[model samples]
Target: MQKLQFEALRRIGLTLAVAQELIHLLEQHPGCIPVRVTEVHRETVRLDDGTQDLPARRMPSLARGLADQDDAVAVGDWGLARCDAHGDWWLTHCLQPFSALVRRDGDGLRHIVVSNVDTALLVMGLDLDFSLRRIERFLALVQASGVRPVVVLSKPDLCADMPRALAQLQARLPADVPHVVLDGRNAAAAEVLAPWLAPAQTLVLLGSSGAGKSTLANTLMGHAVQETGATREGDGRGRHTTTSRSLHRLPGGACLIDTPGVRTLRPDASEASLAASFNDVARLSLQCRFRDCQHRGEPGCAVREGVDGDRLNNFHKLQREMRRDTLTALERRQQLSEWKARGRAGRANLRAKRGE
Candidate 1:
């Protein structure tokens, strides 16, 4: 048996901890090969063993015994593969991911965007696609995923007033959340993002279409690895160029995953998770008089007094969405009457606060 280069595996973002985990799993299942899932499709998945792109499917028995979608193959997942007598490979078991980017869809089920991510490049074009609210949403999702976030404000050259735009973004965000304003098409991205893109690190680009994610991915990769598309002239919204989440080796030994443009990201996170993203608000809430204060008409509500009104509204809006998502369809239907009443009451409270 030929020995394997664990260094080759590290080039694909495999850390020493994961290597030991793979070794332990392989110890139990002899003759099984460890492969990283780079691309997952409807029927088949693409595997990378640090040597070649081996297209593989799940073993029939393994496929039948799948617990849920999480057990299904996905990019950034490490899987154990075994070759049959005919020499065809089949992915048998998926190893646990150290970190994962996940969100809840309208169905309220967790959708794992990408697994084993070290850093997330939260891209936002300085063009019409820019919004602080959207950035806040991404922050919640990233924080919940336990992945560090670096806000990449793409296409600075396109902004009419770069300083004003930057100031507005910096106002809402914390001072500690590092943000970089750059033209993603140029070579400067590799330098500006160097802190997170060191060798053996794995970074994922996350943003809406037309946010210059694919362009940055190509720039960092030192080639046109991911296809770039232009945003519409009207709204500056981009088309879906990268249709799936796929990982590729970068020029500097780190790996990058280019995900399809997301129209919306509903964080499948708890209120504490939401508060982690909005630390300023959370800190203010600690000063509130009541322990369970909702910040509406409550005395000594620091959140109402200190926090910006627009941010407060946004926080409440997301909280309502999360609460609604937790309810089942039947429960939602049953509560539709009281839900409308609460909406009316909430609006009345808002109006009262404004009139105050």
Candidate 2:
């Protein structure tokens, strides 16, 4: 069946295997139907392409799987959906993600915002929203996703003290990662992003709303494909402009997925990602007297002695957050196991009552 599907897809002009993977992913949903993703909206995904066999159709599907839901793949993910002969569409399953930016949602579930991305552009406006701690959160999430993360500081014109802001950013970020502070509204700035914007690569723009993600995306695509809005004056926060997760193909052969503004991001991180994100801290900690030194009031603690008190304090804060995330995940897992065990016990009691 898979071979035939591939052969059929080949007959059409769509030479990519991505759509096929998407179809397979959605097939896991028992009642889903195959639909081609032409465009996506905040609530519904527009499906009407030559690849789809259904009658010229555009129907509403649940955004539930796309939001704050565990095992739910985000935009840029291909899945097999169950949309029957009646034109109803239900997402059945998601394809295995090559890469994704995931964070813990309100329900304590891992939410995938963007998936199968080659690059994650961590957008931060050079204006008020710029903070090293916030950037660290994003870096933690990106590191957890196992994808390359590039930082782009937007709205350079708004910053009165550009040098100071840049200094702070530079101080927190490692020397190896690429970081750019650019005017999202400018064409020349788009050219500076050309290397990652090359053909065939897929990148996602992520930041708080009004960070100029949509603006940067539009500039790169050489067209106003997304809506743009001014930043809020009341608190210097950005109003939600790009309310949907949508994918666009650039003339340069790259693809970009613009996502809604994320207000709060929980670090659903792994130990490896935490270590990688805070490698400096890790390196310093290794020099401590005890192998398991907590670096707090421990005699001959090299980490405590060598690093600045403020910098060490920040590292410890990040460490505490990482540990908290791990504990939370463990607690959730334990509760789930307990619930399942109770269910099993109840089933056993019922079976015995039935005289097995």
Candidate 3:
């Protein structure tokens, strides 16, 4: 009976690793039941117990324990819930996600977009929504989370010069990361994206508004599961038709999560992740004359010679942002003071050199 119950859970994206972890948790908590968090509200969360969806509230102790964490509970997270005497389910504990898509907000807080994602289908519209720099940012985020990323070039029909656009993307993107071009509204998307839609695998669609993430989800599911919207004629930017992140079961047995368009995507990555994402620049930096070459007009700078100017600039920008985010309040103030001191000293040295 337990095996049959687990088989049903497998249809909803329960893997061997997660099942093992749940078994351990069940051993610890005798009466608690394993549930997948489908949706999270302000005070309650909706969980799927493989058979049905139920509203569950977080225990006060559990909420307090995760108060300092980046997110209390994200979509696709598994948790252990227990029912009270009144028959209302209360989420007791949220299991740590094996993988998570996280991004840093402007306020320096980490925001988890989704959890336990196996593959990230980075949906970028081939129209006005296409940008290689933004895709690189997404790659960094996905790579840092230990999730596989496949670039999905959506709305290929809307592109004026499809060949040129694809050529530019291939030139900038990493060769190992697979990219596919297809119309999301067509039924053929399922066939085009079949390799990653295998049973028990979980995929998430991430892109800006009007990128056709929802449309692709519907096509893959063979029905209108998510609502679709039109993009602005002037800017080609789509409205936020999908407000919340939610998971859907595909006909192929894989789970798909659709998220709303993100306006600002600051990558929550480490230095190693940044280096791996921009491997080309990182490799070239080793050939520079100076070991710590900034690649800013420095003599014998191989990064500047080998890498594209714009891509190199974007790498430097992300590096700076990551450094700033990791700094403490006191460290930031001290760094500002040091910069002021250096500026004053540089001005004095100029006066001395000019005999002023």
For model 1, how does the per-residue alpha-carbon lDDT over 240-284 read when each residue is reduced to its tens digit? 988999999998889999999986879877888888877888898
Q: In candidate 2, what are the lDDT values of residues 238-318, reduced to their tens digit?
A: 888887887776766666788888756877777678777767767888888889888889887887776556666766776
lDDT of all predictions: 0.85, 0.69, 0.89
Q: TM-score each candidate.
A: 0.91, 0.73, 0.92
Candidate that beats the other on TM-score, 1 or 2, i.e. the better one: 1
Q: How accurate is candidate 2 locally (lDDT)?
A: 0.69
What's the true lDDT of residue 135 in model 1?
Answer: 91
- Model 2 clash count equals 17
Rank ordering of all candidates by lDDT, starting from the highest:
3, 1, 2
Error of 1 at 83 (Å): 2.8
How far residue 298's Cα lies from its native spot in candidate 3, in Å, is 0.8
